[model samples]
Target: MKHNVILVVLDGLNYQVARHALGHLQAYCDAGRAALYRLDCELPSLSRPLYECILTGVPPIASGVVHNDVVRLSNQRSIFHYARAAGLTTAAAAYHWVSELYNRAPFEAVRDRHTDDADLPIQYGHFYYADHYPDSHLLADAEHLRLRHKPNFLLVHPMNIDDAGHKHGLDSPQYRNSARRADIILADYLQAWLEAGYQVLVTADHGMNTDRSHNGLLPEEREVPLFVLGSAFSLDAAVRPRQTELCGTVCELLGVEHDKPVCRELLK
Candidate 1:
């Protein structure tokens, strides 16, 4: 079974950025499945709600984490909580609002509010931070966690490219360059993991629009990539084209029985 799952959420990443970073992402695509889909939601695509939904395998309202400031009303356990319950060690590296919402004081190790140099480690549970983009330092830290502690779940969030894209617009060279850099960083990190015989799952929390404006709910904003690597899983050959589905797809891959009532679909 694919016990060790590494989730990479690139905040505000779009298809254009992905294509620009194609070289870096090639290995991930070649190694496993690459499913692209339209997010199909409203505008102002905020990070907290989307991420929370991804984690809990529930919609934003059910998860109760919508927007950055609005916290979930109840305990509202997440994938991390479920992972812990299942006896899997969980670690996270998030940025911007994800770190603020998920990485609480005692349960997580968080870093950096604006810059991309934040690198913190968690002995157990989850580690989250918001670095501008992917970095060698963060990749090294993840490797250490996997090699030294062997955590079952490790989440890494890279924000620089997304920040640049939002600030400078997606068409700008700055956005393209940032995407390329992120791709390279991801390739290097995955190389290390593969060398260590580790399986990797690379994906995004949501996609961004070149328009450079969002209110947290839109199809473009919600649609994201779901790429997987390693020897355990196989890319559905019939489903070569991009497709969309609820976050429960991830739950299925990890062997976690999702409580929400929904039929599972693959990218076909």
Candidate 2:
């Protein structure tokens, strides 16, 4: 493991939508510069549960994070904890929920779900509810913070697609447009991280259905994308890795060891 990692989780995005919007994906895959995967992230596809599974390499039910209202995670074996123990700086830029779970994590968390990462206080600008959390600002601010912090283990979430799906059904123009926007921003960050000698993994927590619903066992809700770039992975490989596998993949990338039911080395 000679490289750092930047994992961009496009919350609730699908491969078709990503391919249609992020044309660069297919191009990079064709050029053998990245690996694209379609995988299932098991039940309770909600963000909180999915994130717990992704970080701990364990299923939601087993991990005890079956819902979004999970107060905090005391899992000492979490990816963030492993990264810290491995002597790598970690940062998660998204909503506050991630920080709440990894609050004890030695991370420069710059989430605006309730706290502001800027000079302005809460009275000046802050999110009071999930509904008020705009993806545009969150993604933009997160991007800047990552560039500044330059953490070896970074988890950046661009959630406008999920937000759009919630507001407008899957078939709405806004939903597709939101996916396209995510691609634009992700592409930029991907390039930046790659140029800085960091491997990048882009995936989704879950997928959305036509009815703008999830947390079910539908194909759309279960299947999500896993795109890896600037790693030791074989380019253009047909990888159907599980979502939970990403946790250990990152640990392997950072030369960190984990206990019990470790995920496989996906990129290799």
Candidate 3:
């Protein structure tokens, strides 16, 4: 049987937080393939561009999604577009507009609420808060869709940990606690999908630095995590170390041929 794919993106998450959120992410590492690599550059590691790189298997330059407001030339055409065109039911539950902005084409159903108003307290250079509506609404929506619609391509974006880390710094107890909260939420969501016999892919757009800044392409802002779990892919030693290679890697894992350009360095 063709397996359904769900991609969970934990924004601004770092390796240390993943370790702390071990209970939620460990199974993916234990039962599937996992890896860690330092990102290619420094700060201003914006989320939209980084996620576009992940979804399109190309760099920001090629993807044309460098910032939150920058629109791609192929606006309604992307990896998700390709996925849905091939008959996969695609949907997204994100906490920010960037996900919708970057992967708008593939998602038949997209739901996200903007949290960028200056009136709100800024956490980690972005407008993410621990007890924000985006977090609860997104997770609830994802759970509902997973249970009801059962989309072939489901993507989730959780912003709590990153928000906490940015507001209180990476090593603060709030960051650690937020990580745990994210873990619980993720574990519950994964368990629901697992019980339903669906394949799951967990990763992040980029890692956060101790300094709580990502304006450039520093190693911390570039390095991210990739964990694939489910009956389709096995946990083996075939994992390779590649930063900025997530887009191509995801395409390969999904058995989808990306007609568009991919980062050659990642494939190498």
Best by TM-score: 2
Cα lDDT tens digits, model 1, 27-55, are 45654534333233322356667666666
The lDDT-based order of candidates, best leading, equals 2, 3, 1
Deviation in Å, model 1, residue 16 alpha carbon = 3.4
**Model 2 worst lDDT run, 10 consecutive residues:** 119-128
Model 2 per-residue lDDT tens digits across residues 1-268: 5568877888888667775677776668778788778888778988888887787777888888888877664463677777777666676666555665665232233444434332211111122235335666666665665666666777777677888888886678988888887776666556767788888888888888888878988877788888888856655454457776788887887777676343354556
Ten-residue stretch with the least lDDT total in model 3: 118-127
Candidate 3 lDDT by residue in tens digits, 192-226:
68667666766677667678656565555666666
- Count of clashes, each model: 26, 0, 16
Whole-model lDDT, candidate 1? 0.55
TM-score versus the correct structure, for each prediction: 0.75, 0.85, 0.75
253: Cα error in model 2, Å:
0.5
Question: Best lDDT goes to which candidate?
Answer: 2
